[model samples]
Target: MAAALELFGARDPDDISIDDVAAAAGASRALVYHYFSGKRELYVAALRSAAAGLERRPPPAGGAGSLDALAGALARYFDFAEEHAAGFTALLRGGGAGRCGEVGKIVEGVRGELFASLTRRLPVREPGALLRVTLGSWIAIVESAALDWLEHRDVERRALERLLVDQMVATLTAAARHDPEASHVLHNLKNDR
Candidate 1:
């Protein structure tokens, strides 16, 4: 799996083959087959392993249910991308068709976790609708920013990450302030001031 990840980082996922991985791992092709049904499965496994590693890392401390938490999550995501560029690309591309079913599940699990986290921080009148829009928009922005960073390697990754995090925090904070449930919370803060 590590060999596969290294190869994936060096080339496109479709260009990688079981033979390549097996040779790199010094394992028999049959052994690779025994573990993975096909190349797609192996690729998904590599990506899943990487994603699980990222998931296990704790979110930043302080402001557990606030925009700070969201920023921390985004920072973690960017850090993962920066460190494991190939693994991140494989994980993102594995969502396409003709891939392992488990890949979809992994993507769904991450999306669900992110949505749940954002939803918990949100004070929405219609939680479901608000969550859908907020999470979708947030993901779109982050994905776009990451892709942009990938295309321009010379760009400052940390600055780009901070810019995205700032945008997300500002957008979510504004939305929450207007939300009926959050309005009271905002009102209390203003009163306390």
Candidate 2:
């Protein structure tokens, strides 16, 4: 899997051959085929393995139910992003992730899980459209910023995380102004302040 991830992380699934994976793994091509029926199967398995390593250090002792808890979660996430630069880049913002339906679905699954996890931390139990959209936007922003940080190292990881959290709060406020339903959630966040 490590060999596959290294290769796939560097290029698209279609570009990588089973022979390449086997060579990198220091295993026979037949052995690689023995484990995975084919290249696509191996690609998906390796991608899934990379995604699984993202298991966070369980949020703060309290939970992601508060901004404080979210900061902690973001810190852990930022740390993961910093440490797994190649994997994070390839899995999240990589060029070919959206090309293949199978890989795209895998990427979407990971994204949905991330969205679900972050929302579960919110004070709002049943978020409305505006709130949901706002949060989703924030996640996208964080991903974009992480990509920039990976390439540029323009800011400290902690600073980047804090910047994302602050922007999310600002987004919540804007969402509140535009949507009555989101306003209520914003009120809850403000009350926490």
Candidate 3:
């Protein structure tokens, strides 16, 4: 799986073959075939592996302010992003295997899980449309920033993490003005700190 991820990361999945994965893993082609019926199966398994690794890390400990928790989560996020650079870029940019049937589901599942995890940490009883849209936008921003950071490497990781967390606060703060629920959530965040 690691071999497949490395191969997929460096090049498009369509360009990689069973032989490539076998050679990278130092195993015979037959062995690779024995485990995976074909290239697509192996590719999906490798992507599932990557997704699992990213989700394995626990969110920041309880009682940490929402902002602190967000910072911690973003740090772990960037760690995975850095480790999987090309694969991460390919996944978020909707290129390569990510567009395939199973692959697309996996990507959407990851995004949904991430959205749920972050919002569950908030004090809101239920997230209304305004807050939902606000958080969704924040997630998009993080993905875009990660892609840009991978391509340019101009911003330091820590600075970028801080910037993202600030963006979240700024976004929430703005939403609070028009949304009472959002206002309550923002008030809790301030008090939590």
Candidate 4:
């Protein structure tokens, strides 16, 4: 499972064979087959393993207004993306893991967990519709930025991390202008800061 998880995250799932996993694990192909019926099953299991790693990460701890905590969270996210570059691409591209039903669910579960993680860091106990939308949009932005960063590799990681943090603050500031719920949260966040 560890071998498959590493390979799947670094290379295209289609390119990986049972033999490759066996070789990487120093086990026989027969042993691999003993655990998994086929390559797809193994791939799904590897993806599930990958998802669990991300899901298990503790939410960043600090005050709601702590931009430093947000930056720390972004740093960890980028570390994961960097470690799983090709796998992260495949998971988000809708051409690899997204093609499989189980794979899609795994990916969505990761996104949902990330969303919940962000919400927990905010001042709001329960977010209103507009704040919810704002948070959702911010997640999309972060994902898109990570994808672009992986493909281009032009922006420094620290710069990109700071940029994402600023983007979230700007988004919340904008949302607060028109939303009482957002306004309240923003006010609290600023006070804590």
Candidate 5:
């Protein structure tokens, strides 16, 4: 499973084969077949394995108390992407519209977790239609930025995390302008931070 996870993370699913996974794991192709139904099953399992421990590794709030929750989330996420660069990239880029149903669901499940986490931390009273859209948009923006950061490696991770957190704060601040409840939420966030 570890070998399969690394290979799937590091290469396109099409580029990898049962033979490759077996080779990586120092097992025979027949043995691999005994464990997994087939390639697709193994590939999806690899993705699931890679994502297993990531959902709970929230970043530390140390020195980021000003933007505590947002900062913590971004820092942990940045670290996860950096640590599993290949898998993270594959999950975001490969699992898309044209992908297999299971693959797409796995990808969207991770994304949905992200959206849910951020929305939960937010201090909104009644999350409206626009607010939901806005929160989802923020998730998209942060994910793209993290992918870019992983590929480029030019910007420092801390800088990237800071940029994303600030961008989100600005977005919420702007939203607060037109929404009284959002305004209250923003005020609470500011005071709490």
Candidate 6:
């Protein structure tokens, strides 16, 4: 599964055959079939496994008290992407629209965890909407950056990661400050100023 994910970031769940995965894993194709019914099921299982691994590897502690947790989480996210490029790519790129079905649910599970982590550190009252916008934008940027890094290995990963994080923080902070729920607070601060 890891090998297959490494090979194709995220193609049609049905497109990836048991034989393909077996070839990648150096296992008998029969064994692969014996374990999994088809590509969709296997892909879902792979996603679950990946999510589990990521959850087990906790992000660094200590950033929670300082609002620096966002930076730390972004750093950790980039590090994870760099180290497990294939798996991370697969997780980010896979599945279809709506997240209603099995595969979609798994994808949503992964995305939900990321959104929760990001919003937990922020003061946003409408966390759901804010998290959606923030995560969607972040994903787009990271995906583009990842592809660029793939093509041009000369670019520094740390530099790109820091830039992404900085931009995300600025955007989220501004949005939080402007949120209607915080309007009173902002108005008070403005008057004080």
Runs off by more than 4 Å, candidate 1 = 95-101, 122-128, 173-193
lDDT of 3 by residue, 1-193 (tens): 8778878877878788899999999999999999999988888888777788788877776465466777888998999999987567656654475347887887887799888887778876568999999989999999889989998999999999999988988998999899988888778877775
RMSD each, Å: 3.8, 2.4, 1.7, 2.2, 2.7, 5.3
TM values, all candidates = 0.76, 0.85, 0.93, 0.87, 0.87, 0.71
Tens digit per residue, CA lDDT, model 4, 99-177: 5988888889989998888777777778889999998998899999999999899999999999998898899899989
Clashing pairs in 1: none
Residue 38 CA error for candidate 5 (Å)? 1.2
lDDT of 2 by residue, 4-41 (tens): 78787777766778899899999999999889998878
By TM-score, who's the top model here?
3
- After TM-score superposition, the amount by which residue 98's alpha carbon in candidate 3 deviates from its true location, in angstroms, is 8.9
| Better by lDDT, candidate 4 or 1 | 4
| TM-score, structure 3 vs. true | 0.93
> Candidate 6 local accuracy as lDDT?
0.62
TM-score of candidate 6 relative to the true fold: 0.71
Give the lDDT of residue 31 in candidate 3: 99
State the lDDT at 44 in candidate 2: 73
- Clash pairs, candidate 3, are none
lDDT for each residue of candidate 6 in 61-115, tens digit (9 for 90 to 100): 6544233455566667666767676666566655432242665566677667766
Q: For model 5, what is the alpha-carbon lDDT of residue 66?
A: 42
- Order of candidate numbers by TM-score, starting with the best: 3, 4, 5, 2, 1, 6
Off by over 4 Å in 5: 58-66, 95-98
| Candidate 4 ranges beyond 4 A from true positions | 94-98
